[model samples]
Target: MYSPVQPMHIPDGFLSTLVSIVFWVISIVVLGYALKRVGKDLGERQMPLMGVLAAAIFAGQMLNFSVAGGTSGHLLGATLATILLGPWAAMIVMTSVASIQALIFQDGGLLALGANLFNMAVIGVMVSYFTYTSVQKLARGKAWGIFTGGALAAWTSIVIASLAAALQLALSGTSPANIAVPAMGGIHMIIGLGEGLITFGALAFLYATRRDLFHVGEAAPKGSKAIWVGGLAIAALLAVLSPLASTHPDGLEWVAGQKGFLEAARAPLYNLVPNYVFPGISNGSLATIVAGIIGVVLVFAVALGVAYLRRGRKRSK
Candidate 1:
């Protein structure tokens, strides 16, 4: 199942400042690698769509669906993005979403940013992309192949990401393998099922309406203005619906509760403000909504900035 922060449910004080800082560095390095992989082919035409995808993933993450026993998990959207934009680009987009969630919403820990990015961005996009591609080829591009590949990729990414997080927790001495691994893995398995279904459905819809969008070959049609518009509309819809998402604690919290490490979680260093609430935001729902709005703008800005920078570099050459 998908874990929090994988979809941005990182609570206060989940990791040490040192661990978090280290991850931040790792994230930067991975992001740089992703940019180089993306190269200059990311044209102006892709900027708007990239922004829309960022916002959509951010908002989609907010909508937590109920899992078994009232536990809930949200959509990861990584597989869908990778399927649409290629894995390398999806890494950039997902990292933007994760970074914005940390800086703006304070939803994820600053120190753990790199670990979160590694799990959600690196694994979700890159690893899942390859897995989905393999599955697609095995299925020979049938509808079921796309559906199954999307589902399995989403599911596997969550489990892998959870393992990564668990290892971090164990290494930090905050948790033991007995507690961290099995609990995180067990809950996420359930969560990943929901992730799989949502991915399958989204891919199915895209395939039905715009099959050309999924083509990952030289002969594929260039993305059109319509795709950008459609993507934005979807992002807007997800943003509007984010407030109605599940409020239940995610897999990590649930695991913490079950394993008795819930109280052991340390507070983050950046908790200068009470409850880490952004100024002028009282209700959690309002704060979350505002964060989602800010995330849309930030993601759009970052994507456009990266695109233009790359474009400029290309023109100079």
Candidate 2:
């Protein structure tokens, strides 16, 4: 039984055209604001940081850990990005990741991309930012406070994202609200624990080693070659480990399956690295690694390009 690498994203037919169009409008407005905000104060060092963060998130998404009841989940990375890059820049990075996943990897449906962007990039990132900030204020910025904030923020983001997706499915009449909400929301609660732990551990590591990275969003330090190199190295390492990711259905897929809407998923318009396997690669593990590495590079390039283009626009004004 060969399972496609479907993450927590809605496929094409799952969303009605009207619903999809509405989300597209909303996503466009929000992302346009994000671009404007980032452009206004984009720094030289921030370019590489954006690229590195995008690459890291892309690679991290490849390693899906299994949750209970035959479901799987991966790091949404919205909270991590928001904490490190601010909400605006984090939105850019997350949109890049989601776009690449849909257009290149075919992980999600093209028609449903707007909804995905809204769910993960906008709602998830915003929820994470506010939750973390509230916790940080309560703890007075202590190490324990930051770590707690990151964990809680990450968990809440995932749950909220799932709820948004569930609402979309219900509104589309793909699944009833009674079934969709509970099924989508319940399993994700367990899945969110994994996200929370990963986020907490990541924050703890950074707090121990590179406390200055936290300041990159406010006044980024001058570009450091070592940081970029180290960042890429970490992404590459995650790609190398992508082969070991669990093959179970993610929250969305599992809910779709249980609710009898899994068959509504449509094939992508095109295939670049379909299902995270490189072309002409017989070995499954090797092919996944190759595909993952390529995804990392592509995401890095896109993020850097966006950063530079925005900076250029700001200078021209």
Candidate 3:
């Protein structure tokens, strides 16, 4: 559920060094494109909210919910962020979250940074963008429709990314295609439900509070009961249920175990650090709580820093 690094769950050595290097290159190129687009689309006021939204997404990811059996799932929050901030900004936020998780928690391998970014940032953000847009058109801005669309889009993106990872593993000969793809896809399908529900509820609340925020061709709106109360309620639910999330191995782990690659999976070098526990922090319930706090702080800092830089550059120009 709440693996220390969250979304970038492909374990160390899952993909070969060569494959990982290629993913890194692809991720950088895509990220640069996303940033350029975001810099142009987002306005000054949106920056602060974007920072808060990033922190919220990071924190939400740490709150794992039990799926089927002993398996667990957590919110990607990409769908929610994209619905609020649009795809380009969502990519920046998600990439920052993934980067911090890798650097601070050592959960995702640096070598696979590009792969992770591509999966979570590019697919999650951009694909969801189109999906939600289609849904919004169909729903015609109805709250329920928008919420449903966002949820589905978020869920779909995760499944697609999972498939992509499976393909990489198969191509690398780390595992057979027959074994890896379906196994990963099956588990992630279950996980995607949780992601959808979370995204839906968050978006619904945001829309309720700041209806203006969702308006086409306008700056993101500020404040309302929906924002404050909805956010609090969601956070409370996460805190209460996070500890009960699934203990079983996730999609990647399940594939690795079944395909006989689990043994060959080398732990990242950085993971040798004392703090690099799979469960992270204390291996207790508090682990998620602590991780959530850390995630919130890290995302806030990174988002603010990015926003500040963008603003400074604009002012100079």
Candidate 4:
């Protein structure tokens, strides 16, 4: 059976029709609010950063690291996105990214788009933002506190997303809560470790490189050369290391297999690039690398287009 590498991107036929519709409605509403909230802080200067960061996020998701116990997990980047672009923008960026993954890449079910977006975008970003801010305040601005807060928030977001996915499955009668919860929660508990560490390390890099960055309404550092170089480096790394990613099923896939629902997944709306496989590419590794690059470029363009349009609207107003 086929499997996805991303977390909580529940394919079609897994969720009840009602559950899917509810999530879609909920996600759309949240996204509307997210746009308005983000508009307040997304100055023109921040637009380009969103595109580049979106690219980085897209690339990052392609590289799944092992979580041990025969499971794997990729970066959620929701918490990290919150740190970079703030919660609102992160939500928008993440949702857009997830949507593209579903539509063009065929990585997720179109009917299930709403649920996946809700779990990864709304829940992940919103919960992580609150957790990070609270921890930062409680820690009183120390580097350790701030960094630790990021780590905690990253881990929390992953765990919560996992639980939400489990809840969706349970509500759909796909699996028992007792079975889904522990399996998802336990596996993700370990997956969350990498999420936290990566989040903290990225934050530390930013702090060391540009302290004024990530503040509300603040633009990226004026010395942007380093940022560009870093972003490119990350994108390149994702392209290179992705094919080397653990072939083991990710946490969600592993759980589904154990729970016997892995076979329930259905074809996406379109398979333009099924499994992130690029058309006309026979070689598996090369296809994945090409697909990774394409995803980055596509994500960058989408983010830039949105930011550009948002700026245009503001100017018109």
Clashes of each: 9, 0, 0, 0
Comparing candidate 1 with candidate 3, which one achieves the higher TM-score? 3
List candidate 3 segments past 4 Å from native.
5-8, 67-71, 216-317
Cα distance off (Å), candidate 4, residue 164: 0.6
Cα shift from native, residue 73, model 1 (Å): 4.0
Q: Report the lDDT tens digits of candidate 3 across residue range 1-317.
A: 54553434566677776567778887788678767766766578768877787888778877877767776777878778777776667778989887877777777767777777777787676667656766766887566678888888877777767766766676455766666666776767777888888887877787778887776645432322232243234334322322221222253345444654433454554456655455455476777788899999999999999999999999999
- Residue 153 of model 3: what lDDT? 83
RMSD versus native structure for model 4? 17.9
Per-candidate TM-scores read: 0.64, 0.66, 0.64, 0.64
Error of 2 at 189 (Å): 0.7
Worst lDDT window (10 residues) for model 4? 240-249
- Candidate 1 lDDT, tens digit per residue, 1-317? 43354433344366655556666787678678667656665777787888898999888887877767777766878888888887667888998888888778776776677778876787566557656766877987677888898898888767666766765565455666556666776777778888898888888898889988877443322332332343334334322322222122243345444553433454443354565474558677988999999999999999999999999999999
Each model's lDDT = 0.68, 0.74, 0.68, 0.72
* Candidate 1 error regions (>4 Å): 1-12, 67-70, 216-317
Model 2, TM vs. native: 0.66
Colliding pairs, model 2: none
Best by lDDT: 2
